[model samples]
Target: MTRSMCRTRRAGKSAGVVAAALMALAACSSSSDSSSHRATGSAPELSGTVTVFAAASLKESFTALGREFQRQHPGTKVTFSFNGSDSLAAGINAGAPADVFAAASPKTMAVVTDKKSTAGTPATFVRNQLEIATVPGNPHKLSALKDLTASGLKVVLCDRTVPCGAAAEKALAAGKVRLTPVSYEQDVKGALAKVELKEADAALVYKTDVRSAHGKVEGVEFPESARAVNDYPIALLKNAPNAAAAKAFIALVRSAEGQKVLTGAGFLKP
Candidate 1:
């Protein structure tokens, strides 16, 4: 009776061992199935949001490009914070969660570089020249920076801290002209907006802005602008959450596809 009982116990242990082996085999099979599914490009998709802080003048073109990028990368969303180049640089330096940054001038970009906020060297993606923007029909006949100094002319200029304003000062100095503006606007858009609203007779702004404004303002080209050309620099932020997407977006802006759009909207390829 004791021998028979021992044999039964041994058989039960054998069955338990077999069950453990089978369970392990099943887990291995499921793992392999999952790996095969991923190998066949059935893995979960890549998707996320990226934040870009850009110069104020880039508002229109960058917004359009952001839309195009979304169309290309369906799962990615782009949010832009557009403001003065100096202000944007300050935000990034202060640890803003920016995936990318685009500035109107290298001077402003230097702030990011100095703070080590840029992932790599910022590239010159585009260039812009200054233009005198006035109300439709050439009411002021303000075709040049010198025209701003004429009596009864209400000229608006970007603040000295802003890139556009610095460029304007350089052009004015180069042209040997001095004029007092009605207001020193905080940004180029603000200066241009003043002209659009008829708050000022003339304003110095990017030529691209005048084009974007359409019937809102007429653009006047001056030769002095040649000396004050502003370069647009773009870079992926060092702490970017979506570094891959940021790089792809920057590549697109430097690509021929981007150049076409930028030029059409009045930006010169650098």
Candidate 2:
């Protein structure tokens, strides 16, 4: 073969080799980038149920949040036990199968934390102030904490052990008003229910509870509520059966979307 032809053939082979190497490198880089993307974008899959014990006043907001959490994690379910914060704390201390505990006050959360029943420090997520829930239309014109003490008014209150009841007591004291309810309910919902059912003329309950009532009762705000706002704390239980999901749920509760829902339901920001 001629030297010129030989050189041209060698050059062609060299160019082919270079092109192959470049293609191979490009493939490798693409594969590496794809792997990195998967590593960074993919998260561990979470499943199973996360049981939450929360104060009754959180019923509306929390239920909405729970539904959102389940929607975000298709395989997970959020079950809630809504009651008085004190009662829920007692249940946790008694070994209730709970994954999370959301109390209306730090004092009630302490009932569990004091026993080391939580995985980490509890975080305050929201605050709630007191309101007088009167029968719809303010029939008796009950406007303030003192108004609840009027003679012959059937007033209802949450039991003093619960956060709502405790806050009510503080508000009453702050107003320097004395009140004796016809009955003391176990949770804020129960107290609100008394007014809704017309079983009581008025009930001292959380503003959130009154808002959730949706015109079933009329809410009367008093200045004393500022002094008695209750801080709500949430924690993952130490023995949570579904810790992964529980932690995610807690994260959702503190997220901006969660705060929007809570604030819309009349809960105060923490």
Candidate 3:
């Protein structure tokens, strides 16, 4: 072969090799992008029912959040079981079918995590403070933590094992007030219900719970509540029936829109 022809042929072969290398790199880049998208859940459009066992205090806000999540995810369904955080945690430990667990207190959430029932570290999405929930119009003019101790004023409180009860106790202790309740209820809602149904003159419950009652109950914020704040934590279950949906639901709860709803319902941002 002529020298010039040989040089051209060699150069052509080198060009082909470089082109092949570039193509291989492009293919690798595309594969990596796809993998990253999957890992981070690009689009995150999820389906299936995500069963969430949440604290009673979260009933109203979480129900609203669930509807918004379904609206955003189209086919995803969020079903919730709301009760005392301690009770829900116990149910989880007993092999309950739950995709996610949102507790009103870290202690309750620890019940699930300590049992190795969580797929990820729990996140504190909100904090709540206790308030005196009294009957509409405050006939007794109940205004402070100490007011519950008034003579003949029937009061109800959450059981000490629950978050609201724990916070109420702390607040009362901080204010140096001693109260004898007519009943110790299982959850914040139940405590608030005591006032709404007139079963008791007042109940120390979460500010959020009283707000959800929409005037059926009136809320009285006490200074001692600042010391008794409770953090609400959430996590996906280790054996979540719909892991992807559970993750998406949690993301929504931590989102700004979710915070707006929660704050509107009187939950403080974490």
lDDT of each: 0.80, 0.81, 0.80
Model 1 Cα lDDT, one tens digit per residue, 121-218: 89999999999999999977776678889999999999999999999998899899999889998888999999899988889999988977867988
C-alpha positional error of residue 206 in candidate 2 after TM-score superposition, expressed in Å? 0.7
Please report, as a residue range, the 10-residue window in candidate 1 with the lowest summed lDDT: 6-15
Which whole-number lDDT from 0 to 100 does residue 82 have in model 3? 95
> Candidate 2, residues 196-264: lDDT per residue as tens digits?
899999988888778777679888888999999989999999899999999989987897556656766
| lDDT at residue 225 of model 1 (Cα atoms) | 90
Write the residue-wise lDDT of candidate 3 on 175-246 in tens digits. Answer: 999978999999988888888999999998888777678678888888999999999999989899999889
Clashing pairs in 2: none
Deviation of model 3 at 168, angstroms: 0.8
TM-score of 1: 0.83
Say which candidate scores most in TM-score: 2
lDDT of 1 at 212: 75
